[model samples]
Target: MSRMIFVNLPVENLDRSKRFYEAIGARNEPKFTNEAAAMMVLSDTISLMLLTKPFYATFTSKRIADAHSSSQVLLCLSCESPAEVDQLVEAASANGGKADPGPKQDIGGMMYGRSFEDPDGHHWEPMWMDPQMAEAGAHPVESATAVSN
Candidate 1:
């Protein structure tokens, strides 16, 4: 069986966060949803567990970081093309997310990406890469290492 990833996020408002994810194409999995939490399926393998702040806190002893003021992580999704990346970012912006919260990226036509922040300030990046370049293993990291060596 293939492994699946469930990203657990703390949400200030469950309903609003659920709606925002739905607007961006995630579907709710009712089997795991309640007033305090929601299971938003982003793809066959990727799911998001949106937990209310108090509910989230119960999982750990450390104080929750205010995502709006401090970033704990940056999540990224792969896209089919640069246009698809742009489309997702636009949809996020129209649905209460802040578009381009981080700088846009274009790596010599090999990669293109943009970022957005959800209503609760979770950062998401949608990115695309040239298939041929990827298959050839010509990503930026390898190129930079080669140049430095």
Candidate 2:
């Protein structure tokens, strides 16, 4: 069987998180959802298990970190192109999310990335890479400038 990744996160409001994720293109898996948790399907192989804070605490004795105040993880998703990254960021902003306070990244003209924070302050990055630039092994700054144009 293929391995799958389930990124479990504690959410202050399960329903609001569900709406935010769905609005940004995640599909809701009703079969795995309940009042205390929601299964947000990012892809066939990746899922986000959004659990209410109380339910999340049951799985671990450690106190849950407030994502708004401190980050525990930076979740990243890849897109087919730079356009898709922009689209996701736009969708996120339109649905109660905001762009990353930091600047966007252009890696050696091979990769591009943008980030946003959800309502619960979970950080997410959507990125894209150019296969040709990687294959050529071009300098990052040089390629980055070329791609930026």
Q: What TM-score would every model get versus the actual structure? A: 0.92, 0.88
Per-residue C-alpha lDDT of model 2 across residues 30-101, encoded as one tens digit per residue: 999999999999999999999999999999999899888998888889899999999999999999998864
TM-score of 1: 0.92
Per-residue lDDT tens digits of candidate 1, residues 4-23? 99999999999999999999
Q: Model 2 misses residue 68 by how many Å?
A: 1.0
Give candidate 2's error at residue 82 in angstroms: 0.4
* Cα displacement (Å) at residue 39, model 2: 0.4
Which candidate tops TM-score? 1
